[model samples]
Target: MNPNPLKILVLYYSQHGGTQNLARQIARGIESVAGCEAVLRTVPKVSAVCEAVESDIPAAGAPYCSAEDLKTCAALALGSPTRFGNMAAAMKYFLDGTVAQWLGGELIGKPATVFTSAGSLHGGQESTLLTMMLPLLHHGMIISGVPFSEAALGQTRSGGTPYGASHMAGAEGRPELSSHEQQTAFAQGRRLAELAVKLAV
Candidate 1:
């Protein structure tokens, strides 16, 4: 193993665990690349109520993402559950808070990718992935998508898109990913990591 591996941040927001599952698979793919590491982090839920606040640390699952994580990561894999064809408020909120990073070019030239999960097959998975890319674009990060070269992208009937990795969670919000969805997500992550490695050199 390399003495210092490149860190790929897998940041996500999941309400019912579906998005989180996809994030985990993507992380697995990132780790498959030698001299690369996947750093999984999550954002807390947001609420309309002004007084609502999450504890400094989460009760379970990945810890809340920190600005330090963003600064140190060599690459990024962003994920969120579909919310009205867009990213969930929590993920959006987190991204919105990164103006400091954007202005300072903390993410400039870094490779990034997106993933999402949606209820129903037509639940706007692609739109969510695209919307998630907008912030990274503004940050000057190199965005990537799942290319057709990945067989699972062409074969997935449930969830998989050229925009990025995705999953059809069904109306009940199941977190289990189908074989194709898993493969596509893995391919996406591996591709992003490879790009980051090359870019770093």
Candidate 2:
């Protein structure tokens, strides 16, 4: 008999493609684990106008995430570009709508992690990652961060922290991830997947 692979949700919102790249790296890490699959998803852009809207399907990139995706994911990795030391409004908007899942305890006990991209070295990367956990905490998801054993967290000059994987995407726009950033993200993903397997058992 064959068993189903565990699904780990990779969800994020990116404006200049920086955060999205981090999401992809995290997904690669999650998929590296045997019996685990990464389900990459994104949220639609938000608008201040009450009636402003976007197409249900994005013109490019990952499909928008749904409540069902959250319900079914064995684990989750949330990413977003930093906005004044916090999660971007688009990602925040998505999390704000998860009350149904919270009420049903759909995410309780599942493992989760977060990632971010910022224009400057000190551009709230850690703060954004920290704040991103609030909604997951409300959902009762088990949260984990990069361990010191992941040496990249200590050696990275670009972007990396014990809080989560991060990228220092500078003023030019999205640039290739630094080696440390990539390694840290992959490490985080692997860690999350490993914990998910243990928890599921």
Candidate 3:
């Protein structure tokens, strides 16, 4: 491993904080590995009206992500709350701006993963994870998913998938992560970090 610590970017857009909870767990997993650090970031909500604007700094939670962050990360863990079976507009907007990174091949060989939260068990959790992976794929990132060997993947009745970590927030939109979901997120993050470290080596 390199002397300098690897930076794993944990980026997400969360409306009700469920996705944010997942992000934290993933970060924890990344940090569990030596010589790896997790950089947590979030995107601002988009306004339909062109005239609307948001403050540069978020009022709470993570700060907005920068293109430089994406360019420099050793690995990425992307997340979002499912929006009609897809990733939310805020995350899409942030990713759309990464064309410059794509052109530069800044992320070409980096490992990447995805996660999501939804309102129900059958909600678009998996679909949202897939859609989130599209941009990473375009950036030529090596995608990694949670494997079935993780105990949570096979046992979680809530929200665990081979695609990535997820949460079933139910109708009330709770932010608390279930134990199984937490383990799944940690496992995904650890896997991503481990892959990144090996690739960096």
Candidate 4:
């Protein structure tokens, strides 16, 4: 019998829609691969207090990420909006809650990638991407980044980095990803999904 299809989880936290848009483009890229699927998930916003006000299930958009989703995923593409050169608190909060999975080594062998969107060109896109990877690295995940072979990396005047996929949203909070940025993000997802498939069996 044929084994189950590979599933690449596209997990993200978006405050102003930029990160969400990037996640969608990456999902499209993941689905473009044969024998692979993209499971989109989101982390809810964190409150200043110890407990958040959100319900167990989100009212809209993708559902909150479950630990099972992380364990069962063939690959992972994590994204978040830039927040002072780091991933937003919400995403970090979600990851911090994954201690059980980390101790179990559930994601140790999975291929992973990172992505981010910033309000400005120099708004710590790369640093934000790097920060998002730290916890995954601690979980022993194999990290993958966009190779320079992708033309978008060279031509993108807006946002395209070898660290991962990125976007430059103007100060007005506009999230019009450039052709290069979008292509690079898609390529990242495709590469992650493909690598996950290769590692699955």
lDDT of 1: 0.93
- TM-score between model 4 and native: 0.95
Which regions of candidate 4 are displaced past 4 Å? 1-3, 49-52
Query: Lowest-scoring 10 consecutive residues by lDDT in candidate 2?
Result: 47-56
Compared with the true structure, what per-residue lDDT tens digits does model 3 show for residues 86-111? 99998898898888898999999999
| Model 1 Cα lDDT, one tens digit per residue, 1-201 | 899999999999998888899999999999999999999999988877622766888899999999999999999999999999999998888899999999899999999999999999999998899989999999999999988999998788999999998989897889999999999999999999999999999
Query: How would the candidate models be sorted by lDDT, starting from the highest?
Result: 3, 1, 2, 4
Q: Name the lDDT value of residue 198 in candidate 1.
A: 100
lDDT of 1 at 54: 65
Q: lDDT tens string, model 4, 1-201?
A: 226678789999987778888898999999888888889999988886536456888778888888889988988999999999999998998899999999999999899999999999999999999888899999999999999999999998998899999989989887778899899989998999889878976
Q: Which one wins by TM-score: 1 or 4? A: 1
Candidate 4 local distance difference test against the native: 0.90
Q: What are the TM-scores, per candidate, against the unseen true structure?
A: 0.97, 0.96, 0.96, 0.95
Write the candidate numbers in order of decreasing TM-score: 1, 3, 2, 4
Candidates in order have lDDT scores of 0.93, 0.91, 0.93, 0.90
Looking at model 4, residue 28 earns an lDDT score of 90
Error of 2 at 172 (Å): 1.3
Most accurate candidate by TM-score: 1
**Model 1 lDDT-worst window of ten:** 45-54
| lDDT per residue as tens, model 2, 1-201 | 118999999998988887888888898998889989999999988886622667878999999998889999999999999999999988898899888898999999999999999999999998899999999999999999999999888888999989999999889876579999999999999999999999989
Clashes of 2: 0
